[model samples]
Target: MQDGLLYKLAALDSEFEQIHRLNYETFVEEIPQHGENPERRLVDKFHGENTYIVCLDGEELAGMLAVRDKRPFSLDQKLPGLDSYLPRSRSLCELRLLCVKKERRYRKVLLGLFTKLAAYCEEKKYDLAIISANVAQGKLYRNLGFIPFGPEVGSDGARYQPMYLTPESYYGMKERTKLLSRMDGEASVSQKHMNLLPGPVDVSADTERAMAGTPVSHRTEEFNEDLARVKQILSSITGAKHTAVLMGSGTLANDAVAAQLSLTEGNGLILSNGEFGERLIDHARRWGLSFCTIEKQWGGRFSREETEKALDKNPGASWLWAVHSETSTGVLNDAGMLGEICADRGIDLCLDCISSLGTVPLDLARVYMATGVSGKGLRSYPGLSFVFYNHEIASRPDKLPRYLDLGLYAESAGTPFTLSSNLLSALKASISNFSAEERYAELRKRSDWLREKLSDAGYDIVAEKGQESPAVITIPLPERLVSRVLGMKLERSGYYINWRSVYLLERNCVQIALMGECREDSLSPLIGLLRDEMKSRHRA
Candidate 1:
């Protein structure tokens, strides 16, 4: 079961039941380690604490293993002098219940187990691993870099050897045709922790290396060339005639848009269907602009007819503001529809497309102005923001703050103050040759797959179906389970999902945003944790 088998962390009740059955099959019927029971299920005493990574052949369990970092391992009881036998490790984890089905014959099953084990160790930062290897397969264990560290333990008929594995010894294995090294080569070494944060997300190794050298002066030609390149890539992605790379958050970009809007005379209509939409309203209000609003529930979406009606009521509304992707609620308002509506009416359109820019293909060549950030969707370091506009602006040196003045940024060649060359270099690396079309399809594919899996596993997604953003999925936790508690629990298990923030806490919601460097191997394992959580709540 090479490609047919699935190797991932054990998270669901069904998987756990199968695991227990396999435990009975391996430990009781095969090894005689435990007495047989009528239930035909042998639960490991450490089931409460052990983190199980399994190999599955469709619904059936092909093989399984578990890791527990807690002290006083089973080996400690079996061998009195276990501590002296083990080498010093910065952090240690005990691997147990490594049983492969007889049909698997140890090779493929063990290979898959070790592959999953590698990812698990990478996540938990476990440098050294210890296992009680069955003496019958001692040669295979030794081949995989397990060194016998203590005397044999267990009954003569069912003996075991205490062994340890370290990265150095594992790599030093002369035989290198194993699955662990082959399947996950560079990914395992670099991206040990899977980051699921909405923003300040993980950057690629190349992106990090782009920022490694000494910072160049912003005034220098080299730094200015990088500035021009990033701006060109952003313009290509959004189709904006001009883009200003500002040094701040997405809010700063929006603030600059507000300053631009302050010059317009007529009333504008702000759209609000989520938290970010409300923030847009705040941006308008703080700028002292007179604006009407079309407000909806946080996760609700705006239809074209409703938007048209709002514009109709606010007769002579000169501009319209809306958020393309609502990060807080995982709702994506239709920017195209809104843009079309505004275009026909001659209403200038301003958008907060921060979370949508790199995740989806956006056409904004005809739009008035929009905001984006380097970190969230672009997968770069966070210190930079961009404001994209199609129209030219008059410099408002007297009316607007220097940073908020879009005209100043454009007129001064997108550099009014000193900017971090490191940030710009990383940003350029991330966005250069921007492939928004391909990224859009991939992001949607993964989001659809993940959403279906989560839905089938008894999780309640916050955004209504067909209205949710493919880049982020907001899940409302059950009334009994606090998002903070559940989110932190997953974090301890090596998944850093989004929760604990004020907005998420207020709504009892957690988000899984597939922003940067997401892959099938990393995303699929997350479902087990989610399913496990659902099963636990039901049991309670």
Candidate 2:
């Protein structure tokens, strides 16, 4: 309903009306599972316990399925020793009454409902799910990662087979969309907006497959080994001495860096040329770290002279902080030069390398501390952030907040608190598969080509030549054109440009990111689309 499709919990009177009709059509009319009734409605016996997930296509119920965790499942009654027949599990659920309109053509109704089912199971911590699937739809069910178990039940055309779904089994089927596309002819990948944002970039199938695997205890040796391996790879790539993985975002990682900076004996010099740089000043302020800031216009390049003058003015500065890539303006500061300056001045250097880490070649060996995330150019899912440090850090249980305490995380081998093995596994797969040489070249070449295309199309690029980062390209809207208006238009057309962030809105800007697996040819159409938007604006 919202943008032609909506997946939600079935609650409304109207939604229930459609659900009952669809259930009757599926169970009675189609499957011959129920006796015909005058009302033509066949609500399930477990309707009271059922949590129905429905897909709505402009107020029309496209498809639906109900989940109920209460025991004495429909399958339990049909197949007498259900528990004995199945694998051991802590908690199980029953999924029933699945249906999509048989008379109408639906785009992704059933796919959307099944995705919701998977998410709901995760939220409820259901280890396994049981379904008495229609025998005729066995291939479709198996394609959805359901395993058939026990003997068939019911008479003739109404036969049903007991099936179960587990995370491992689901992942096995969902291992790659390539398999699905090959088997089903068309890719069953549900509706996806073209991802051109800076973070939460389109992840690879390997990363998805890794994330789909069942999680292990964070405290287990198996989990710690994965943790150590990821840390080692990160350190090796960035030339950082150590890396501490935390279950948070880039902002949280920066806060951790600020906590470390707070320990410095003298003042720190923070430079602000864009949004992320300004955030560093805020982080330092909140941490009560004594610091001086050198402010410049957004997208302005910080020269060696400007930084040297700032350090000279604050001779006693113990550390320096700045963003390696000012994501808001798409300006990439020279991390190498900054690292050298700090080395010569005997000051610790820290960088917010959140957006720059994977897009650019980094040598953080000289950097005292820096921050990165699991998403961004890594092409992994978000939620995991890293604090890379060049020195051994000890636990500081007394001074900093427990979660932001980098020392605590470092001393404990990056898992002082619970960590998500799902995110960790995905990150490992992405990093392991990443080709630094190839990816860097691709981003740089693509960034240059896109900037040229946009510029030739009569649009102003925010970052001037020699200042732009390969990761994101920020474009300011013209005086008459509203950012939100243009962004909405692009989104409805399936291109998700970054424009809704508070800072971007304040600046009246939108962005195109080259953070993930983007191609030059893939961007030509987008450039033409932008050119069309501008042409229409001019015509109007």
Candidate 3:
């Protein structure tokens, strides 16, 4: 047991009896007694197969609940009617024997245990949950959206109410309550404090109007003209002569790059420190590309020596890939240094700048190729991806398929092969309002403010001060709080944060990026909430 709580599966030995004793104490001694010999009931066959999640507060057994196959429990003759509403299929689960020690009843301990049970049911894909709610607790189940299947009846003269809860109903109630509570909490905070959380950064009115314009035929000359305009603007922003606008996501852009590079003769080097980098390697391997990697753990950054050594060892490598801003770790690698090394070695450098682009300083002059999306730092809708490559790679005519060929895009179609004129107009409008330099400066300012606020609140950042990405700020969560709990708590408090898990071999941490309309003002209330949550955890 740690932190005054014991969380574990119930054992069949003395611990199980202890839980039974607590159940008797709560139901028989404390509450109204419905069954005879409640103090010492014999262990039944049902108890043998059921799994129980037992929680103890210090030496005191605080709670115990039994979960068993729903089919048997729902269909059993001993229980009140449920077959009328529920199907006999094995798609359901039953939650039984929910008992919390008297002291822990209203303290959220039972709620926490029930929340875990709900999560477990959802994960296991159980379609429904059935419970024989007692008369006194019938309103509790009703409030939770559990409907009674049949008339209330007594089990051996012990008044019980038969209830049924579908997975959809349960989750719907859960999510609705969460959203309502979140909105209420946000409203409780001052508007000045509320605005601290990131965006609904309203898109420019002109840009929205442009996007609302009539759609153009993809094959029409007018469409090509709009496409050309978008291509020029995209290239100007990234300092690349070659840029492509695809109908798919940024993943497609990475796929295209991987497909194009894998056609080469030699091995490739993948620099992986976060989820996206590892995703790139997965894409390469899926496409059967020969590759080696220099990996850093999650929330960890690679040193210059480590990168140089990987390049030195893989002398045959003709292509190198790394993420400019690893959204997972919120760390920005030294792209310029890596680019120079790859260029000098006659290797093509590909960068995943999906979360970086307009938020950071990028020079297409240094890197050979890069992939970005319209959504994340570009602040547009997510349908399009821009692929930028240097003149050398853009001029290559070798083995790339027509669709994946950057050379073909450069020489002929420019950005769009089959374009959405409205998206093109939106891209132009988003870029026209702000220069690349202005975007970079604004991002830097916002990220700095965020870092300061988080640091003031006593959070440890994943990246070093000066080495962090201007677009993202990653913070290490306290060991006592799981990422899921942290995310749910923040969501309830009207803030959404991303958590990292891909490089689990390294560390578990949370990341907060300033890409959206997030501001420093939102941080104050969030810090207060964090402090409260920390106190609650410590108390638990």
- The C-alpha TM-scores of every prediction are 0.77, 0.67, 0.61
* CA deviation > 4 Å runs, candidate 3: 1-202, 392-402, 414-416, 499-508
- Residue 332 local lDDT, model 3: 85
Candidate 2, lDDT over the whole model: 0.84
State the local distance difference test value for candidate 3. Answer: 0.69
Tens-place lDDT per residue, model 1, 276-362, is: 898999988888999999999878889999999988898979999999999998998888899889889998998899999899778
Q: lDDT at 12 for candidate 2?
A: 50
lDDT pick, better of 1 and 2? 1
Best by lDDT: 1
Model 3 C-alpha lDDT per residue in residues 1-540, reported as the tens digit of each score? 223554445532445678767766655555545354834643535776677777766445678777887356733665544566665545777777788876677535554455556645665677777777888788877867687876665544356677777766776766766643343233233211122211223355677887899987777777787777777777777888677777778898998888778667899899898778889989898889998998887667777788779878988998899898887667888888887788778988889988778778778866667898876776665577877876554545565666777666666654437767787777677777657776788778877877786776667788787778887766666767676677655653346666534442235565566665555654555665666655556777
Clashing pairs in 3: 196-521, 196-522, 198-518
* Ranking of candidates on TM-score, top first: 1, 2, 3
**Candidate 2 versus the native: TM-score?**
0.67
| Candidate closer to the true structure by TM-score (higher is better), 1 or 3 | 1
RMSD of 1: 4.9
> Which scores higher on TM-score, 1 or 2?
1
Off by over 4 Å in 2: 1-192
